[model samples]
Target: MRSSVRERETVARWDVARPSWPSRTAGVSLAGFRDSSAGPVDVPLVPHPAVTLVVEFGDGLFVVGDATGRQQRGSLVAGLAPGAVRMRGENVTCVEVRLSPVVAYAVLGVCPAELDRTVVALDDLWGRDLSRIREQLADAASWEDRFALTDSLLARRRETGPLVDPEVARVWDRIVISRGRVRIEDLADEVGWSRRLLWSRFRSQIGLPPKRAATLVRFRHAAHRLAAGDNAVRVAADCGYVDQSHLHREVVAFTGMTPSTLAGDPGLAVDDIAWAEPVAHLGVMRKT
Candidate 1:
């Protein structure tokens, strides 16, 4: 299904499309975005707890750059917690895929560690197949067709690629279930591994150390809460921060914006419609 979204105080507009049903492959969510504004678009890219792949089509200028000024145009893959990024373009059209880091290792055919905290050209990882997929997506007749094509490609890659350790996967699930409040030591104990081993294995397979992963997950939840109009003090307390300032530091660390500014960001304003199920499950507002 598709919907139109406009920022509350700006002229920026987007036609957002969501899949009719859940992806057949677990831990995968798809959304298609087409910029409909008359002028160029620029917005902060908020960090989330998953690996992101953007497949750009149409004759538009799409660019993603980091805080360091490194930039890539067209299709790209961003690993977990890529800090302080921004997306800019004109007439942008793309299918954005969010892959749970647990499943990302297999579907991407590489360890998440390789992509940790950075964005790389999809072509750099997928090679020529990236071109073929772009062609197919651009040729697809409708949003549903594009979703099906993307899902099929991911399912095939996941079936053939190496899976992460069961213990590590379990830990990731625990982290999400607890909303990142779970302790790494407790998780290691529950999984019957030494703290050191779990730390090394999770970092290698899931992209971030256990502690860092928890922090990112926590921040993801807190960010959505902020965007939903929750009071900062309440969000900070509920999300496990020591105080509001601690939450402030994390918000600035992740997006280079203070809480109030991020809460009103246009990119996050579209998140509720674009990622409805995940956002709902995390207990954030239905509209941001």
Candidate 2:
């Protein structure tokens, strides 16, 4: 079986490259999440074109699609643990479909015993070429055929829960509007709650604070500049840092690696997608 993506609008669509990964052919599959292209999302690494995916197996694998004329060239990678926070650089376009852990939990509904096992087994299949699936969708296939298939997979996994909570939605909205550069206090105020209340919501829902989110946003900006060969000073300034050292110091605090090290460290390059979570989403350029 294959996973399908349907783009009903001209604005944003999943631009998948031709089928690869011979291992992708059958099993469970789900659609990608829908996100806005109004601004940039802070992700790790400087991915050229990527297909960002968030599945259930060991924190879903990160993907990017840099198809010509189809998407932008930049970097953004995230894990599937809680919320996947990614940053796509300017001129980098891609459709990110990262399912929340809650979504997986909802899909599973706590029935399957080998939750991770089932997800891992079907992980590759989830991303298999969905051209067939897309075609059926384009032809206005039955909702049961599409949605029901997904439901069945979750049922098999015994994962079930609410798709997401209101607090999660609230924080995500803040991330988009602020470009990942807002404060926890501000978020607290916006939601008409106290700091402790906001923190509780964050830990339980988003799993991170407003400050961490802001940090990641800044870090993403700086990483993009470095990938594009931007001067550290300029990148720092552009990303809301006091100076180049500010960028480096904060990046170290959050990522334990320097921008210079990241740029030169070819080993860090892999399947060609940002995949790890930093200490928190501190500014790549202004964490400390």
Candidate 3:
């Protein structure tokens, strides 16, 4: 009976029928978006700690790197983007999965560090596996099926791929659960590792060192609050900034926009339609 109950729970957890493909799996969430615009729309992609996988089923989605000045069109893996980027495409339809850095190595077969502030074609990373998934996504009958296919593929890949160090995973989870409020020293102690060793391993596997990762996670929470119509001053105070000035600097650094401008950013506005609920479910978007 317990086994039967567990099976039922598992099915319920993987139910792809949810609004934005909230998964029962930790460290993974998926969202499907469809746009019919004839001309391209620019979306200011915010830098976050997650490694994102974008699979397009319709028109191409081009990732334009602000620094590299190169554009990658079609399915891709965006790794721990350090600064703002933009996505330009028209009549776009895609399924985007955000992977917590903790599990990205297992799913992508590459350390998040390799992708730091870079975008690579998905075919380059996953090879033929990505092409196969794209075909499956395009052929799938409905959004639910597409999500289910995506989830099953991720689950299979993660199960087969090598995992990050357990200690590193624990530290990442702690930072995320604390919404980036925890200290690196405390995390090292909790995970039974010296600070130096923890820093090295964490950066190698998770893309960013502990301190920077914490700040990125915190900033994402603050960005969401601003988008939700929270006052910039209150958001700064609530998200642990030293002052509104500090908050402004962090926001500008990550997004290249001031707090008020970020709040009004049409690009940042896509979170409402595409990822708002799944992000909250992932625990990245915290109540604080």
Candidate 4:
């Protein structure tokens, strides 16, 4: 997705690159983005089920905050936040990693729950190590080299960080496999826990409660389809929404946009460009 000037007079171009990651790096995928723009720009970002790590090496980027007027900096970790967000930046080059909530704790040494609906500086998680990584990334000769450095760092963290509860992991896997269509009660029963216990544990481990996570996952699928030119009505039906209206509400709730507006959103349309190649590569790695 070569970003071009939009109707709003902002000249923007984004190039995405994929790097080979280790097979042992399960539940994670990496993408590199190079953005060249005339000046500062605002891009809308909607909610997603997974956590994200953004490391920027060019002009600063920050998550635009509401009410409190607090902005999260580049080189940040963002949890499964709700509503809409606008990323403000100019001439940014960065590497982004998408981490499944199941592996977030292991990779970051922080429970997903503590990060619920929030973004924080990566240094807050990895301390001085983040500065060192940023310096190395800035000096790296190629995107592949930067990716390798990041993979090594995350691998070490995952190896040493606390493991998630087995039952919690199982519940998460089921939700993904079902594409968020699975019932909460069914998940609770499958995990051998009462509904109350399952709810508490799942939220603690995965950030969002089971039901909310499922909704996000389902909405993510629908959003991608819409971005791919699928009809909203068909997407709603295929994604298990009651109807187009139901899908509309979900889209509005997560993105603060109507279905048509979200379909035209460049930030989301670029996700395919950013993730498709790396995700496909990761799948092949898993099979081997």
**Regions of candidate 2 where Cα sits further than 4 Å from its true position:** 1-97, 100-160, 264-288
Please give the lDDT score for candidate 2.
0.40
TM-score of 2: 0.45
**Model 1 misplacement above 4 A:** 1-12, 278-288
Clashing pairs in 3: none
Q: For model 3, how does the per-residue alpha-carbon lDDT over 1-288 read when each residue is reduced to its tens digit?
A: 435423432322211223344565578878766653445667677876699888877545555556557788888888885476777776667788989888899899998899888788888888888888888988888777888888999898888877789999999888888989998999999989999999999999899889999999899889989976899899999999999999999998887789898886755555544454523322111110
Best-to-worst ranking by TM-score:
1, 4, 3, 2
TM-score of each: 0.93, 0.45, 0.85, 0.88
Whole-model Cα lDDT of every candidate shown, in order = 0.87, 0.40, 0.76, 0.77
Off by more than 4 A, model 4 = 1-12, 59-63, 66-69, 277-288
Candidate 2 lDDT by residue in tens digits, 20-40: 111111212333222223444
- CA-RMSD of model 2: 14.8
Error of 4 at 173 (Å): 1.2
How many backbone clashes are present in model 1? 0
